[model samples]
Target: MRVFRIAKKQYLEDLSGEGSRLFGGRWNKKGMPMLYFSDSLSTSLLEVLVHLDFKHLTKDFGYIEIDIPDNLIDTKLKLKDLDDNWRDNPPKSITTNLGTAFLKANKKLALKVPCAILPMASNILINPKHKDFTKLKVIKVADLDIDSRLIVDTK
Candidate 1:
């Protein structure tokens, strides 16, 4: 399947998930780095906007397209199928193990999805870390669906 990830130009070739681990995201706290991806490009755009700490937006970002065989993904934890409030508060035990495993193995094993609306997924916790995490195909977008002031630079 094809998944999309929006990131800065400088990070276009970086998929180590180290950047995310260093900077905690909405789903995982500090020390946990997950390679976030979305089923929809529009959804990825929404995530980039919402996750930013600043209000204004002038920086340009690129869209990365990844092709991962469905068979390779082992969905150990599916937050989308959960009934509890997985967004505001995710299960600690699961997140902890996934984080620890990712740190050790380097490959993604679990899919941490907070909600279906976001359509987000990450293989940052995969076991037996992948050597070429940044080899995924990428498309630079100079103009997105939103206003130019909001985003630009899609190549």
Candidate 2:
């Protein structure tokens, strides 16, 4: 299975999950290393765009395509499996706790979860500590050109 991650150009080559670990995210708490990937390029873009602003708009950005063996992703968490407020903006503990547990368990390299921005779409969470994490393959990485319309002059 192929997954996509959008990030700054310089960090595109760094798959260490260090950024996510230090800052945490909707799924993982601070200090937990986890890589977030979207099923499609468009979704990846959207995921990054939400966290970006005009200042970040001018910076170099890129996207990465990673290939993961289908069998490695044996676990999935559907929308129905989550609480009604799972999509809350601040991200409730229910969601983070669930993800934290998954990472601690280290039972699977990848977990299929619903995207909060677009529930119809899905995001893949990767546990860098997983034993089979090395099985993930980085197939492609290239510059991402964000639409000018998406940027606004704050000044």
lDDT of each: 0.54, 0.87
lDDT of 2 by residue, 1-155 (tens): 99999888898878788998998888999899899999999999888878776667665888899999999885557788999999897889988898889999888889889989999998999998899988999999988877778888677
Leading candidate by lDDT? 2
lDDT for model 1, please.
Answer: 0.54
Question: All candidates' TM-scores?
Answer: 0.62, 0.92
| RMSD for each of the candidates | 5.6, 1.5
Give the lDDT of residue 49 in candidate 1: 74
**Backbone collision tally, model 1:** 15
In candidate 2, stretches whose alpha carbon ends up further than 4 angstroms from where it belongs are: 153-155
Candidate 1 on 105-136: residue-level lDDT in tens? 54544343443345353432322245544344
